[model samples]
Target: MGWFLGLGIAGLVVLALSLVFDGVLEGVGGGLDGLLSLPVIAGFVSALGFTGALATGAAGAGAVLATLAGIAAGTLAGWATWSFSRALLRDGAPAPRGEDLTGTSGAVVTAIPAGGYGEVLLHLAGQPVKYAAKAAAPVARGAEVWVESVLSPTSVTVRPVER
Candidate 1:
């Protein structure tokens, strides 16, 4: 009982921490997966061996308390892993940030069709750029392409290229 309770408390603390660490506003998936590790957390706590001893310490009142705490801790760890994986790893094609067409590889989303309006995919940069690009041919939105030429501040011209 006591063991389960204590373990439970630990679990809840860890779970809550994981949630706050990888909240939605943080941008679903980029590189934050390294924070929470269930095995690491649980194994570390279990190593103390206090939980086991507490649960089975005396086979009397002590046993009941210890069992409770151990269960609590285990539950918390499970919850943490579940929450972190869901919030941080949402799957979606990463889109370009700004008009930064520098050193990136993306396909023309809106075919330049002409010049005033063409789309190119550059590896999304930290800061997104706001510019238009031109391409020789129509750069299909999903076409595999790269930034060929950067015209101006918010303007870039791109063409197809091999990966």
Candidate 2:
């Protein structure tokens, strides 16, 4: 019982150290492909020690039986920790690009002369942004326009909206 408690305490100390020095041991396995991350090891050790103590103290199990139970619990804890960490590290949606502005609608901020450039207030990624605009025909300030194509990183070709 005394040894089991000591092991449990040691496991907790290792877990604390892992949190404080995160990524330090990430390359320890060299070729394991992140299977031996600090969090996974910490979870395994902590679960093993605590479960062993519980099995022995609460269930009155012998040392061998308690150890077996602890190993099973530790493996499960390690696998779950690995899965959760991988899920969090996975890539998310790609960022919005200037090309995505084509076909979107906006309002002309500066009156556009035919065959010239003006400014339009457009929404890119749901946020208002101003961009240089060109049209085949003159457009008045505050008139709604539809983007026809993106000409550059900061410019677009547009047509006045009918409605």
Candidate 3:
């Protein structure tokens, strides 16, 4: 095969490897994100490889530059792929309630101080979701609490969250 053709194949292989590792298209709201991710990454990565090959030719160092360029391109591709995969396989996406933390159930990890301080762990999507918890009634460690609402970035108000 011609140099350009071989280069094209190598570039594609790099891109695929990157996508398998990087995760550029994860959780893209599942619509346009799912459809357009591939073509976009492919076009961008191909352009990069083509440019690298051109640079290699101009420098009269085609063989060396081509190998290194393929490696670099593969690296970029891998990063994108990993990122996309992560988005697609998000572990515990925030409950679609937009932080409206009402009636969440968790077990208190520490005694809840009335003034505002504590910790709790609960299951959100089969994952251990821990949040700072506090309540009007003092809660002992291991006590069940209902997350009445989210009070701050790391905290939630609580009551009894009956099983």
Candidate 4:
């Protein structure tokens, strides 16, 4: 009973440290996170080992068997948790809407030759977004332009601003 409580406390401390730091100590590598994270493995294994030992009336020799069982159980649990969390938190970015660009003013990043593609930089959602641009006539670099239409998701048509 005493061993169980001690191990449980130690496991809780390890989990707390892992959460509080949140990989700031990942200089050595990120083995402290993901499915094989040390804190998670330790917490699961220690809790299970304590429970198993108590349930089976495990004594000195039986302690080793209980520990081995705990390790196997912990590994599976950790893997399952990691996989589930990753699926839920998968990388995804919102699509930039086309209507958001039309009529917006931007500056030419590259000189636009007559009927040719150049680049323009516009501020969208407080971030700079660069898109391919075109003009009916030549537009010099750093010249202000107005977005005429969205040519594609990543490109746009623009015209030089008069004076």
Which number leads on lDDT?
A: 2
- Best-fitting candidate, measured by TM-score? 2
Q: Candidate 2 — which residues are off by over 4 angstroms?
A: 1-24, 87-96, 106-145
| Alpha-carbon TM-score of each model against the true structure | 0.36, 0.60, 0.45, 0.44
The clash count of every prediction, one per candidate, is 39, 0, 21, 0
Q: How far off is residue 40 in model 1, in Å?
A: 13
lDDT by residue for model 4 over 56-156, one digit each (tens)?
A: 46555366676666566656665765666567768576766866899999999999999999999987766898998888899999999999988888888
Question: Compared with the true structure, what per-residue lDDT tens digits does model 2 show for residues 45-110?
Answer: 778888889999999999999889888998999899889988888868679999999999999999
What are the Cα lDDT values of the candidates? 0.55, 0.89, 0.65, 0.73
Which stretches of model 4 miss by more than 4 angstroms? 1-95
lDDT of 2 at 111: 92
lDDT score, candidate 2:
0.89
Worst 10 residues of 4 by lDDT: 23-32
Task: For model 4, state the Cα shift of residue 115 in Å.
Answer: 0.6
Q: What tens digits encode model 3's per-residue C-alpha lDDT throughout 1-163?
A: 1464455666577567756754466456375444335534554456456655665766655666666765576557646754776577687656644165566677888778776788898665557777887788778889988777777767778886545
By TM-score rank, best first, the candidates go: 2, 3, 4, 1
Look at candidate 4 and tell me the lDDT of residue 135.
Answer: 87
Better model by TM-score: candidate 1 vs candidate 4: 4
Model 3 lDDT, residue 31, Cα? 58
Clashing pairs in 2: none
